[model samples]
Target: MASQQTVFMNHGQGETSYARNSSIQNADQERMKPMIEAAIAELCTANNGLSRGNIVIADLGCSSGPNALTLVSFAVEAIHKHYLELQQPPPELCVLLNDLPDNDFNTVVKNLTTLRRSDEPVVVTGVTPGSFYERLFTAESLHLACSSNSLHWLSKAPEDLTRNQIPAYDIDEHARRERLPLVVEAYANQFKKDFTLFLKLRAKESVPGGKIVVSLLGRRSEGISSKFPRLVEILLQILSVTASEGVFEKKKLNSFYVPVYEPSDEELREIIQEEGSFWINEMCVHGLTSGMDSALITPNRLANQMRAVFEPLVAQHLGDVMDEFVRTAEQRWSLEGSLQDEVARLATVAVSLTKA
Candidate 1:
């Protein structure tokens, strides 16, 4: 597996920048508000009468954008509401916004200071730049940790996938679907390893009885025919067209891989149990429809949304051809049939766990 070094969100302000195209992710984060509240409440209650003076919370893979600060705001407000319900003074908050080193931490903090609610407890936000697969905090320092739409990212691409010049989710290109079981297994096993290490690290950093909430894009189906993977197929076709043109080397696409895997519900449960650091308190899969409305699914918007996420990775490999590739994707999407009458459902798995 190739270790990921710069898997951060798109930066700056533009139509394709993460700031503008992250509505889907923001909606997903909003969907996690209740889960965050519940987790914080559990953390507060588990402390009994202990003062808990300073509450430590980490938002792992906290990308830089509006949605990132929105997550912090939700957590702060959740903790405030919990303290209010308990008729206790709110504890000082120590929030660690974590992501890859390439993330725009300055923008994250600036946005945090802007979006922070005045009524929320005093929060001292810090930037933790590193991979979540590694330990970032001291032992027993954290009270609650939450991640949204992030855990699906693997620490590295599967070695076999890279070796075979197969992108992680490109199961439909070049007769790759015929090798579905092997490819999916490789991705799943990689996720299991990364997620297991994640659990173990968080377990050590978290105080006994601490809480963690994680929400990730995943699949209910065991096969590669899911909507997300199918979407990647469309993207692959678009890339293939770009490759057909002399714009870039065709072999580059073969070598490029996105270090991400969307696991199934059963796979997640199995890994959590195998990790054995935390007990699952609540686990559920939620469906998300793009902001194009349940009745309207425009591919242009969807493609741009996907592009915003993947442009950084693609640019790293494709370099100057990145713009042409994105344009080709947009054109391909614009020619697609109207899906307005269809309701496209995407799965997101939310799990809340407590330290054992």
Candidate 2:
């Protein structure tokens, strides 16, 4: 995994860019729209309208892509609708789209210009470049906060797992899976620390009763059930099988690990409660399909999606071996039969919370 300062989404509109291959994430965000609206409405109604007669909205992990701007649009429309319901004029809007410093802000700004409405004035928008794990805003300076499809990324890969022979993502191998008890525990502990700090920072930045709507990749079962684990398992199996045929070195494969973690619904609830700064308003898990509903699920689309996301992480670790890794994995899938017949599902949890 890359350092915190360098962690970022694949950029530009090329084949591997997050902008081109974020359909699954976009679908998840679409499913989260109602929750976003409801949270905004809840915030507006409770404060005798827009709290300070101005609205400050921030997207904490607003990566460089359509989804980042899409989130901004959702928040803007939701807040606009709230004012309409109150029969009051809308407040001045301050929008903050945040991501790590390495993110392609130029791409984000270009996309924003193409999507802007001519009738509406340019928003007071700021591009915030930093890890969301730290403070970025002044105290009580924000009213609504929104983030989607981002929190699953940890502050850093688990230090314990990186030093070991078994990569953190190899959940399918029985021997490795057995040894993962401690590794899983370490990931969970890191998540707790990161999330606790996230809550603390947000509490300090938001006014009392301010609302935050977050939709992140998570699991429905307390046990590991999400396709993320299985996806990496398939990749690991491919590498192992190909290495036996002298396609690559087994040593190289064992050392690479992607720094990501998915939480179950129960885990998220517990963390929110334990953090003690926010009151949970809504927390639910939704199972999302990665491909078309009527067609059979194939490796082509899934592999492409994985490439868009994991390419950076894999490249950062494996360096020159990244190409071989991708090729062998795709070749293995081609030889095998169907991985999924119809539906390939992933679980995501969306939570709406109020600072208290």
Candidate 3:
């Protein structure tokens, strides 16, 4: 098994730029609201009532800030909508915002405090810092578990591969290609472990027939072939140019590959079945077009949004190399006419699961 340290290094921290963007909050609410509402409605109907007991919801990998609260509000509204139809007293609601210990807990608290003004009582609890791969909640306690754009990250690093292999080299195509598989393998193994743990934990924590909604970035299987996708290839090329200009260490360029695997609908269904304890109710793949609502629907805008989420992290790790990489990427995108289209197309998948 890869050590948890590696996973932390690659995936644990939140992107500072993303954390600061109100646009992301707006986009997330718009994207997830209807889906979450529908899932809660189904869960309530299946269980026969919304007033049976306290309703508990957990947002796993919830970064600190208003975004988590936005999710909570959506869940609360869904519950209330169901309650209104039944003419029942609103159920006591418990919202748990969970993330890594290093996350901005203060931000989460500040956001939750603002959300407490609703007429319906909402008990907000912050899970004292922890990894979702391990135990984070008591068994049979959570009614719904929601994780968006978070599960693709591995829970730990691929130590075994790293121990056996030499340091990855960008110029060595064969070595780079070989190392990618190992990295992917390690990420897959950790994803399996975390996902399996998630199902098992939810089984114990969730009431019978409770539901979980997960929305994540995913790619088609064809995207992961021996040759890198155009998007990834472009990123590498930019990194190479930046490195030559002495903006970043040559080795830092090697770390630019996307870490999370984007499973196809079929692949995800298979994994859900194999992992057990949950049944997939709905799955849909859609383009991530919401981020472009106000911006010119060009590829540069799309790339900029991607950079908004990545540049800060790279800067933190690679410093001057980060600036050069961004500049080079922008130049390449401009030259390639990458943003010719009015809309930037990205693939995303959302799935609803129920306790088995």
Candidate 4:
């Protein structure tokens, strides 16, 4: 309902910075590699637009940090790899890194110098800053556009949720997920409207036969959220404690809304069909289920991970309680049972589309 409200990952570097806490995104991109490669191969063979001498590919929601350019590198390498398989020279690459205007573009730009590559490919880059739901590029100016782990963030929280018309968070010091039936309907409708508008705008910007690959966190079942432990509920639980301690106003906790919605694969397909701008090439709802097993899971690490994502948004309402909040979160998450369930399952929806 609201338009163009910004949500951002923690921009700079630190334990709580998105750059450090974003390892899971690397896994998401790795799972998406096959879909990306296939799309590039099809773009090379099926579309004659590759002859234009320069290929323009956009990595939407390219948040800053080490993983920022990972997708961009994937597109570039995939195109060149396809050309190499055919023993042909790949065209020049024009890379666009897109994110919210508030995103840490500086970190991404700084990391560009460290990438290993040769000059034969001649990669030129630019930064596109704006909401992807709006027209961020010229008409028919792109060959491929991809987004990862970002679409779940709506253009804004539902106006009803923000205004406390829908009872997502309660007057008491707790999040009301059981009372989320109306909350689910409101969020679903908002995501449908935003995602449909996204398709239409990209259709106007992309070539007639361009490709779009998108992967974001989604529900496995046909519901608003996953059956597994919800990390959001954990965050709300901590926030409510802060409110009860008189750190923030009770009404603030009641009114603050998370501007994100994880749609099911069915809901995604429905929106794509109804929009009618792109043909679904490949679609799936399976991703890393093993979750964060890389290292010993610690409460500090887990809280920092969630804090990197939520600090900016949470700070808007809670003010200077962020450090104290993170401290409190760490204290709560220190128990053995706190995070083993939350980090056990990570599901994502990946779709490859061709402009019709």
Best by lDDT: 4
Give the distance in Å from residue 167's predicted Cα in candidate 3 to where it truly belongs.
5.8
Overall local distance difference test of candidate 1: 0.75
The lDDT values for all models are 0.75, 0.72, 0.62, 0.78
| Number of clashing pairs per prediction, in order | 0, 0, 7, 0
- Tell me the tens digit of each residue's lDDT in model 3 across 1-356: 12323222222224424454334334644687777888888877776234456888888877654566667678887887788889987668778888777666765676676645457655555554677777777767777888877776556434455455433235567777767666556656655666777677777777777878887665554444532223334455666777777776677655443435555556667778998888888887765556446454443444554564445444554564544565666676675445543123345567888888
> Which prediction has more favorable lDDT, 3 or 4?
4
Candidate 4: count the clashes: 0
lDDT of 2 at 94: 82
Q: Measured by TM-score, how close is model 3 to the native structure?
A: 0.82
Cα RMSD (angstroms) for every candidate in the order listed: 3.1, 3.3, 4.2, 2.9
Task: Provide the lDDT at 48 for model 3.
Answer: 28
On residues 1-356, what C-alpha lDDT tens digit does candidate 2 reach at each position?
Answer: 33432467788888878887777778778877887888777777776336557778888887877888777688888877777787777777788888988888998877765534564434577778888889888888888888998888888767776656546644346756676677678777877788888999999999777778888876776555432444445556665665666665666666666556678888889999998999998888876554345243355556666677776666565454445655665665565454443123356788999887
Error in Å for residue 272 of model 2: 0.7
Which stretches of model 1 miss by more than 4 angstroms? 48-50, 115-121, 163-175, 222-231, 290-292, 295-297, 335-345
Residue 336, model 4: Cα distance from true site in angstroms? 3.5
Off by over 4 Å in 3: 1-16, 22-29, 48-52, 125-128, 166-169, 178-183, 221-237, 252-259, 290-304, 311-317, 340-345
Regions of model 4 farther than 4 Å from truth: 1-5, 113-117, 163-167, 173-179, 222-229, 287-297
